[model samples]
Target: MDGDLRGWRQCLLSGAVFAVCMAGTTLPTPLYGLYQEKFDFSELTVTVVYAVYAVGVIGVLLLAGNASDAVGRRPVLLWGLGAATASAVCFLFATTLGWLYVGRLLSGLSAGLFTGAATAYVMELAPHGGTSRATFLATAANMGGLGCGPLLAGVLAQYADWPLYLPFAVHLALVACSAAVLLRLPETVRERRPLRTVRPQRPGLPPRVRSVFGPAAAATFVGFALFGVFTSVSPSFLAHSLDVRNHAVSGLIVALAFFASTAGQLAVGRFGLGRSLPLGCAALLGGLALLAGALWWDLLPLVVLSALVGGIGHGLAFRGSLAVVAAASEANQRAAVISALFVVAYAGISVPVIGVGLLAGPMGLEGAGLVFIACMMLLVSTAGVYLLRRPAPAAETAGQP
Candidate 1:
């Protein structure tokens, strides 16, 4: 009983650290407009800054995706925390557009290191028979932490003084606390190897797994794309289109999607993975339609509903996809497979957002957003129809256990 208690405590601590690290990545969500005013740049520049983080994340995932497996989780996590702290410091002192790019890039590197390593670390810290609970811990820490970022920043920016500086300062303090918590936890990896053993991450999968990977990756991509647009550019849309310029309101609106996603993920276990994927895609399609309505009519309520409902779809599909792929992968290759899945997911978030930025100047925010929604809607609808026509194999369904 005592041992079990210790393990649970350790898992909780690890999850908290995971949340803190992930929060840094999105801490600037509500503050982008301020940067735009300060630096006098175009919307294209904003998306480019956001995309830079994705590039950093993809770069790390390709080069050192499995670094923690060799060097021990704690070492990699410590470095992630250190990077997060540095990122906060960058934001605190940011004066020009270049500083924003550097801060975002460092934030992405921190998230890249944390995503796989922290999830594995939380699971490893769990006691036997705790895998199911630990999975929730990992997912919640990831999505929940993301939700908190905008909320924290928005509230601080709205109510407190020094909107930009306070948020980063608070994040820096949270990083310090998380680092201290990590020091108290025991190291999970027993045979830690040198960094030289870490090889470049080449995408690898057996022929059998490819069938499930296709639809799963599609759903993950569309879901992340929705979130990407919401976090990066939706504030400008709300302000310029609907005339809602309140920073706290803007932050809360973006945060709503992430919070709804957490709720949606919880629903997946009750709904069953096989059924949830297509259902989620359908919800996503509806969300896209609602978003189009918002764009065309300039309806604030429609935008809010679209964010909430669409976020739920993203959560349901994302967690279902993770379970499906993880079930199909062998234990030895699971880490690599999961890393590949995230590469696809983050690409969804990064590429489409950049496209929106590029088109914003010519088409305007609403026009660019409508184009994005149309494309994502088509992609998600096709995936849903494919899943409905040919359901996931019985073998794959059974593999989920």
Candidate 2:
């Protein structure tokens, strides 16, 4: 009993650390307007700055995604915390657009490293038979931390004295404390390797895993596409179309989607993975519809509803996809396979967002969003149909080893 309590405590501590690192990524979400005012840039610049973080995440996932498996979780997470701190410091001292880009990229690197490592670390730290609860802890920390970022920043930026400076300073202090906490936690990996020995990761899939990977990756791509659009451009949409300019409200709206997603993820176990994927896709399709209505009519309530509903769909579909893929993958190849899954997910975040940015000038933000929704809707709907036609093979249904 004592050992079990100790293990749960460690897992919870790890989740907290993961949340702190992730919070830095979106800390600047609410402050983008402020940066624009100070630097005199366009909306395209904001999307580009946000997209840089995706690029950094994709780069890290491609190059060193398996570093934790090789060198141990604590060291990699410590490095992630360092990157996060650097990102915060960059935001604190930013006087140019370049600084924002640099900060976002570093933040992305921090997230890329933490995403897989921290997820695995949290699960591994759990006592035997506690996998289900640990999964929730890790995922809730991830999405909740992301939700908290804009909320924390928006509140601080809205009411606090140093709008930009205070948030990053707070995050920096949190990162330092996270580092200390991590130092005290026991290392999960038994055999650790030197950082130099970690080789560049190639994006590949073995023949055995390819069958399950296709549809799983597709669902993940669409889920993240939904999130990408919401996080990157929803605030601009809210401010311009609806004429709602409150930073706190905008942040909360975005946060609602992520929070709703946590709820959606929780439903996966109840619905079962096979059913959750298609059901999630159906919900996502509904969300896209709600988003379209909001865009067309310029209704604030519709937008909020779209965020909450769509976020739930995203959560359901994303966690279901992750579970499907993780369960199907071979023990030794799990990290690499998961990295490939994230590559698709991150692409959704980057490419569609840039497309929206490009089209914003010609078509306007509403039209661009509609176009994005239409495209993602088609993609997700197709995946849902496919999953329904042929459920994941029986071989792929087992949980991760």
Candidate 3:
């Protein structure tokens, strides 16, 4: 029908906007080293900067995660775009370490707002019975945009002039264009409310969801931790250890993990949740092992393999975790439960990375990475064994792809 076609078009357009906003979050990933050179900061400062973004994300998720449901998606998303624009501007004119932190925090706020609101918007814009494909579009847009961030920055930083300034400049333009597209798209929320109605949601789990939440949250944590490590520190490792100072190469290495995660997410429907969770765990374990090998032997091949394999594991486990948790929750409690999972995942991103940074001072990057890997490996293995013993219940029936 004509309506279906229109819905799909809108959905795609919204997804593009979503992607652009997310890309800005990672635009600075490849340029951290350049900032370090200019600012003369330590690696510990780098991880702290990265973790600050997670702090922003977590803060938003807890305080205003349901803002779109109250005030409508467009307003919240427009605010997200504004935050992203501020972030880009901060990066463009960054002179001190404080500027980078502020930029990263704003970037995180943009992502935190977009993550749930944009996803819900994309799905709502889809025609009836299009949930499955829309879910893929939203998730792909998320991870794909994240992948594009580093790649775009790295290429521009390597071959183009104004390495630090140009990327954010381009992102600012993209954000402006995205804002235009968003304005034209129809609002999905029918029940408009004042911002006063939006209440802060504390993370909570219903009794039913608690059983499945344990292993699922664990897998999600480890998966995100892997990503956290890759995005935050892998570039430094490549530059210092391998003497691979090419910005494009470092960006590509980080981007590969996110791209691979998107690919892995696409495969989950075929395997189903029951199988995917365990397989995801196994893959995560493999990724951690590959990273260990890369650290120990200083092998570039292993590093690449670790990104591919670990990315897949992250995708599989993350998606599967979402499905399993959704299946176990009562409908009214679903959003809060999902927020709890995200809290855990983002915590994984922040906590472990800061730990690595702390240890990096004494143990060196390689030793710190190995220690981090060893800890994540044990966690993933435990989750894997638990999933095998007790498969998640009713995921195929209740959860959407």
Candidate 4:
């Protein structure tokens, strides 16, 4: 009983550590406007800076996605924390565009390392028969941590001292504390191999996985793209179009989306597997419509509504996609297929963001957003159609998983 108690406690503590690392990733979301003012840059540059983080995440995912499995979770997470610290330091000393770029890149590296390693650690630390609850904890901590970052930074930047420097400073302190907690915990991976033996999992789908991976990847892609645009440029839009200047307000609006997604993920338990993806796609189409309404009517309420509906759709689609993908594969091929899905998801995040940036210059931010919404609507609609025609095999056991 005591050992099981200890196991659960450690798992929660590890979730906290995971949360902290994720918080650092979005700490800059609300501050991008201030950076633009200080550096005198365009919306395109902001997108570039934001997209660079995705690049770093994808690069690491492709190259060392499974390093923790070989060298053990603690070492990989410790390195992740180190990268997060470096990112904070870069932001602290950021006097130039170059520093912003470096900070975002390092933040991405930290997240890329933490996403898989920390999740695995949290689950592994669970006591027997605790996987279900542990999965929820791992996911909630991730989204909650992300939501907290912008809220924290926004409040501080809006009302407190040194808007730019203080947030990163606070994050650095949190990172230091997280490192202490992590170091004191025992290593979860017992039979570790040397680091040199690790190789890139090189994402691929076997023939059996292709059918399931297709629509799942598409849904995942559109969902991530929605979030990427929201985080990367929506602040600028709020200030320019809605004339909403409160940093705290902007941050909260963005945070609402993430929080909504968390709620949506919890709601997935009520859905059967086949229904979740198709219904999720339907929800996504509705979200895209809300976004279109926001743009067409020039209404802030519509934007907020879009965030809520889209976030729910994102959560539902992502969880359903994961379950379906996991169910489709033989046990041996499951992990690699999931990694390939990550690659595609990350691609959706980075690539379209750049396109939006490129369009914002000529079409204007509002115009660019409309274009993005149009493109995503088509993609999501296609995915919805695909899922309705042929649900993934895992759909039958989704809620159970």
Per-residue C-alpha lDDT of model 2 across residues 231-260, encoded as one tens digit per residue:
888888877778878888988988898899
Cα error, candidate 3, residue 327 (Å): 0.7
Evaluate residue 264 in candidate 4 and report its C-alpha lDDT on the 0 to 100 scale: 79
Misplaced by over 4 Å in model 1 are 330-333, 394-401
Q: In candidate 1, what are the lDDT values of residues 1-401, reduced to their tens digit?
A: 99999999999999999998988898899899988888899999889898888887888898888899999999999999988998898899998888899998999999889988999999999999999899889989998899889888988998999998999999999999999999989999999999999998876676767888888899899999999999999989888888888889988988889888988988987788777788889888888898999999999999899989999999888887877777788887776787788899999999999999999999999999999999999899888998888877732474364
Residue 178 of candidate 2: its Cα lDDT? 96
As for candidate 1, its clashing pairs are none
The candidate 1 region of ten consecutive residues with least summed lDDT is 392-401
Collision pairs in model 4: none
Q: Relative to the true structure, how large is the alpha-carbon lDDT of every model?
A: 0.89, 0.87, 0.93, 0.89
RMSD per candidate (Å) reads 1.6, 1.9, 1.3, 1.2
Of the candidates shown, which would achieve the greatest lDDT relative to the real structure?
3
lDDT of 4 by residue, 1-401 (tens): 99999999999999999999999999999999999999999999999999999888988888898999999999999999999999999999998999999999999999999999999999999999999789989999888888888888889999998999999999999999999999988998989999999988777799988888888899999988988888888889888888988999889888888888888788888876657787778878888899888877889998899889988998898888988898888898888889889888888888899999999999998899999999999999998998888766677765564
Q: What is the lDDT of residue 171 in candidate 1?
A: 94
TM-score of each: 0.96, 0.95, 0.98, 0.98
Question: What is the clash count for each candidate, in the order shown?
Answer: 0, 0, 0, 0
State the lDDT of candidate 3 residue by residue for 170-218, as single tens digits: 9999999999999999999999999999899999998888878999899
- Cα displacement (angstroms), candidate 4, residue 193, comes to 0.9
